[model samples]
Target chain A: GESVGLHLPTLSVQEGDNSIINCAYSNSASDYFIWYKQESGKGPQFIIDIRSNMDKRQGQRVTVLLNKTVKHLSLQIAATQPGDSAVYFCAENRDGATNKLIFGTGTLLAVQP
Target chain B: EAGVTQFPSHSVIEKGQTVTLRCDPISGHDNLYWYRRVMGKEIKFLLHFVKESKQDESGMPNNRFLAERTGGTYSTLKVQPAELEDSGVYFCASSQLTGSNTEAFFGQGTRLTVV
Candidate 1:
């Protein structure tokens, strides 16, 4: 049950290499973006987040880049590892709206050793 | 502090039958939400509850889906006369703040299968 879902755009990378996953959002009013990782049989777990004010934010081994002009978001992982193999999702939320997250179809990151 | 918790990790039911899924949010979280991913689709919002009142239900698909947070402590989603399209993974999440995109804690989703 460690598989989020079988149907997702997959990115295969060698262990120790950098991995990048991208997403496109439609809402122009969305002021915050968050990235999540979902393993099999589990819910989406929060990874990192960035507000609309900042173009980039860095966390422990993770970086989130946001481009409000183009409404694009990307997550970069420093090193690919077996444990990092999971479905990654990007979610957006607009200010003054219900605090519900609008999620994108996830990308599965597969680490190849 | 315990994270969000969901009941019945998995369920299989016949079409037109009834299924109820429950979720318990973190002790002090005031905002609770429900989302689901059907088949190969992305997770979509279902509803949101603030305290005992439903803050927003615009994402509810149809009348057959009913959600309630009786005491503002726990919530339940009831799918009556469920259809094949109702089959999906139901996830519950809770956050401490509203109007802000703070991190939401998610529970292990409940996978519902309709045959």
Candidate 2:
């Protein structure tokens, strides 16, 4: 069985500060990873994604780091804002699959305004 | 383009009852998927439809769950004799194609509470 898990269940940060959430996955066969932000009562929203071939990828205000050697992935948010408070989840997809994503237990990001 | 849309945002049903969840994928999207989160657990894939055909259903929990995509348009997930464990948020997502790099657009999800 393949599983993706978070290192922390909750992370708190001050507004304007940087936040980093960590995830560890067991399936080395996974070729793609994505980070999603889920607001309360809303569906998980796409934040950023990185292919296993790359070590890192950057988005508007977010960055995703992948460490295949350690089977770890991280999502970093710069200048965290109040609107950034949400549950963040990491998902992995295998190359040959039909793009079905396996999600990890989310880490709740709490920004103190 | 409109995002994935699901009907009856919330439903409360008794045990052994039946319920159907509908999902309308983004227009022109060729890939649709259904996932579920039970209680506080992580979201798990239920099945996937590539157009009007089921491409993968390996994650479906049991035979009690049936999914359909008649015209490769919208899709439906039906659960009969729903059990207490079936109470959770059911999410529908769509992507432009079936590849490892495509980003999925998700719906708000249907919250099913089986008592």
Clashes by residue pair, model 2: none
Q: Give model 1's docking category.
A: medium
Error of 1 at B92 (Å): 0.3
Q: What residue runs in model 2 are displaced by over 4 Å at the alpha carbon?
A: A1-8
Q: What lDDT tens digits, residue by residue, belong to model 2 across residues A11-89?
A: 9999999999999998999999999988878899999999989999999999999999999999999999999998899
Give me the runs in candidate 1 sitting further than 4 Å from their true place. Answer: A1-6
**What TM value does the first chain of each candidate achieve?**
0.92, 0.91
lDDT, model 2: 0.91
Model 2 chain A poorest ten-residue lDDT run: A1-10
Give the Å shift of residue A49 in candidate 2: 0.7
